[model samples]
Target: MDSATSDESIIAFDKWLETPPGAYVRAWEQACLDKMVANIFGFNAVQIGMPQIDALAANRMPHQWLADIRLHPRQSGTGRAVAVTLDSEELPFATNSMDLVVLPHVLEFSAEPHQVLREVERVLIPEGQVIVCGFNPVSLWGLRQVRGRLTGSHYLPKAGEFISMPRIKDWLKLLNMGVSQTQLGCYAPACRTERWLARYNFMDRAGPNYWPYFGAVYMVQAIKRVKGMRLIGPAWKQKTAKAGVPVPAANKHKESIDG
Candidate 1:
């Protein structure tokens, strides 16, 4: 898709977030993001897209920004404002400057998903963390979405090229970002209305223990790693022994004279 088309799709997806199914997904994502970012220590953090969700609200970073390709009038869940508007494939920040970056459903809608991740890797400092939320294409929800596409209707946004967890892991690996943690959620069946979703709510409780990997949504946390770099602690100097030359010479002379 072209940039204009991609932008329109993102806006559409944003609108979808207000729907019942969308709201369910949003609530799950919000809770997960809150827990994931709570303890991360950092100076600068940036959330790449999906400003409707405050991905950094629980973070304690001194500098946090929400960036998107274009500004939208909608405020985030916590009323956090967008700090900058820029292309995800080409971030404006300096290389290795960001301590954390959150990408919520960004890859699925982007025209150049790999390029977006490359840009994120470029901006993140070594050992910095990145949280990515995406729709899993290997679940019942995914099967329903596929069926919807075949039937000329889409369960999720047609513009989204839903990426699988393994694929995302491979992409991050290629960028030298190691996957540190992963979470799967939204085990309920893919239902269009709130009523059906409520009926299937029991699935959410059992899914984690029965079929954990088949959740509709997945979140991954990765840390940027640089080769041949090691952190060092404070250094200490060894104490030197005092010279015993004068005492040794005098003792030797006195022993010889006595002999």
Candidate 2:
């Protein structure tokens, strides 16, 4: 999609957050994020995109900031805290500076998700943790999304590339990061009404236990790895020679032959 269309799609999706399905997903994500980020101690933490979710609300970092391409001088009201308006593919933070990063559905909306992940790898320090939330493309929600797109009435954002969990893991592995933890939630069907959604609450218990990999949403925690490798071998020997001085090999046969 073009830039204008992408922007409109995101705006429409943000407005949809007020609806029942959107609100349900937001609550699930917030609860998951709270449990994951509460134990991570950091000096600086950044939450990129999805400013409405408040991904760092449970974090105890001394310096917490939210960044998004949509945040601007006019649309500065990003929930509880102010957010900086910047592209996720090009963050302004220094290299190896951020201790933690939270991406709440940013990759799905980004036109260049790989570039955004690369930028996240760049700004984070070694062993820094990154929490990513995404929609699983192999579940009931995924089926609904596909049907919605085919019918031209998507429940989620229409103009995003909904990436799979395995694909995201591969991307992280290529960046020298390892997945530390994985969480799956929101097993209910994509229902527009809260009453119908609550009716399928039993699926929450059954879905994860019977079909572990079929959750509608997933959260992955990854850590950047900095391997320390050193070369071990014999040290090089040095020989000193002064001007007009011959370096002797200390061989008696050479001396006797010369005499």
Candidate 3:
């Protein structure tokens, strides 16, 4: 999608986030993110895109930031958290600098989703945690999007590509990251009204038990992996020397004379 259309879709979705279904999604995502980030200790954490929800709110990391493609003029009003405006595909951070990175629905809305993921991998330190929120393409909401495309009346924003969980996992795997968790939520159908959505709330409990993968949204947590990496120290050196064969006094004297 063109930048204009993409921005429009994002603005529209941010507004929609205030709607009943959107509100439900926000609440669920916030709770999940809060729980997920609480244990992720790091010096610097960056949340790329989706300033509509503070993805790093519960994170205890000393330095937390929210970034997007376009900087918000009134960002200072948002309080202690720093806000940056930069292209998602070309992040400004140093490679392997961030300890935690959160992408709240960034992939589905991105025009260059693969580049964006690559950028995410670039900025994260080894073993750094990444948490992503996305709409599941095999869920009730996905069906709605398909119907919308056929009829040209998208219930969700038209700009989003609505990536599937498997596709995302493949992307992470290709980047040499191990997925640690995949959580499903917002099991209700794509209802237009809040009353209907609330009435169908029972689906949240029933859907996961009966059809776990059919939720409207999913959260994926992955860790960057570096192979053949190990830690060494003075103690390890001392232990290796003790474990090796002892040199004889005659050999030692001969070696010292040769030296």
Q: Give per-model CA RMSD.
A: 5.1, 5.7, 5.8
- Give the C-alpha lDDT of model 3: 0.85
Model 1 per-residue lDDT tens digits across residues 1-259: 8878987888889888888899999889989999999999989999877877788889999899888775454466667777788888889999999999999998998889999999999999989999999999999989998998889788888889999999999999999999999999998888879999999889988988999999999999999999985867444322222333256788899999999
Instruction: Quote the positional error of residue 106 for candidate 1 in Å.
Output: 0.4
Off by over 4 Å in 1: 71-74, 229-259
Q: After superposition, how far is residue 81 of candidate 3 from its true place, in Å?
A: 5.7
**Model 3: per-residue Cα lDDT over 40-79, one tens digit each:** 9979999877666678888899988877764452232235
Whole-model lDDT, model 2: 0.84
- Which structure is stronger by TM-score: 1 or 3? 1
Pick out the ten consecutive residues of candidate 1 with the lowest summed lDDT: 236-245
Global lDDT of each model? 0.88, 0.84, 0.85
- TM-scores for all predictions: 0.86, 0.85, 0.84
Ranking by lDDT: 1, 3, 2
